[model samples]
Target: MSQTRFRARTRIVFSLLALSVMAAPAAAQTIVSTYTPLDLENCRHTAGKAEEDSGVWRCAGFGGIPVHVTANDMRMYVSYGGNAKNEPAARETLASFHGEGTSIEWRSERAANGKLKPFATILRFRTSVADGDKTVPGQVLVVTRLAPGPVCRVGYVDGRANPDANALARKIADERARNFRCGTDKAVVEGATGPGFSPPAE
Candidate 1:
């Protein structure tokens, strides 16, 4: 190859490399962080406080939200429920909480762990209590395994200074449900919903 041509090609390569380097920070920023059982435990008010009951793992306060995880037969079954249409069943699986708020809608219905099984839904909304009271104005995240119905609902009972944790709860549920590979003897969905769940689509 001609020296001039080689030099031109080298310049193009250098430009591409520079672009990639420049783009690195943006890509890193977009990267979501995942959580583990330990991390969830750490979210408690006192930290390292978690309890297991009937195959469900309950955390006092995950990112300021009362969180619970269940990987039972029901959960594993629903996690793999067919397509978006199964979302209704997934919704039903959740035991009703205090009261429904005005904003109720779908958050996401997708494969857990980026696979075809273990589908889950991460829902966001507020409670029906009056807005002025101290106990009012909290958010609820109902993450249900639509395929098999392992619902991990989180409630942010009190307000917090850092609102980012409110969003992180959903991501935690997403990763937990995606990794929901439960079995008879062993039922547990494991993974961190790195960073936080994406804001609901406008």
Candidate 2:
């Protein structure tokens, strides 16, 4: 082959290879199974009339700490209530439900990488247990994701426990938030393509 012709052929081959690479599908991310805390042993799941489109399971025998997971599979509960509007509206709706003394700590309606994301709220507060005037620190995380439909949200609340117990509860909540699968969802932001609830470090 002529040198110029050979160089042209090489360029064509490299171009094809580049195109093929670009056309290849990205590798799928491995999602681990749901995390079950050791504390929840022989706990009875709450049973009651469930909505045709949604379901909830509350597991509570874990040493006085209750863990609940709710799944919404349809468009019935997609909106954050009120006018069924956007993220700000949703945040307003959520804010209405805060306990009398609860304070809003942080929120991320927009994903980290600057994209319009589903509403997510993180709150911290102190709660007092019954019997006496003993109070303990607590954190509640609520995240809403738009996909597959109903915009599944995982609400986790933990309080009135020892340091180790608090750690375990936080871990369970973090894992639950992490491994949840909603639908063919894209990263609301550039970085977090999935649920971005990173439980606060103990």
Index of the highest-lDDT prediction: 1
User: CA lDDT of 73 in candidate 1?
Assistant: 24
lDDT of each: 0.35, 0.32
Per-residue lDDT tens digits of candidate 1, residues 1-202? 9999999999999999999999998655432323323232333232222342124333432122233333332221111222322333222332212322222222344243542222343434333333344333334444444334433232221212235643554555455555554332222222322222121111
In model 2, the worst 10-residue window by lDDT is 187-196
C-alpha RMSD for every candidate: 15.3, 17.0
| Structural similarity to truth (TM-score) of each candidate | 0.36, 0.26
lDDT measured at residue 29 in model 1 versus the true structure, 0 to 100: 45
lDDT of 2 by residue, 1-202 (tens): 8999999999999999998787664322121112223221343444435664234333431123233333232211112322233322122212111221222221223334544322232233222222235433233333343322333344433332233433433343334434445433321211111121223221
Q: Please report how far candidate 1 places residue 77 from its true position, in Å.
A: 18
TM-score of 1: 0.36
Q: Count clashing residue pairs per candidate.
A: 19, 1
Candidate 2 vs. truth: CA RMSD? 17.0
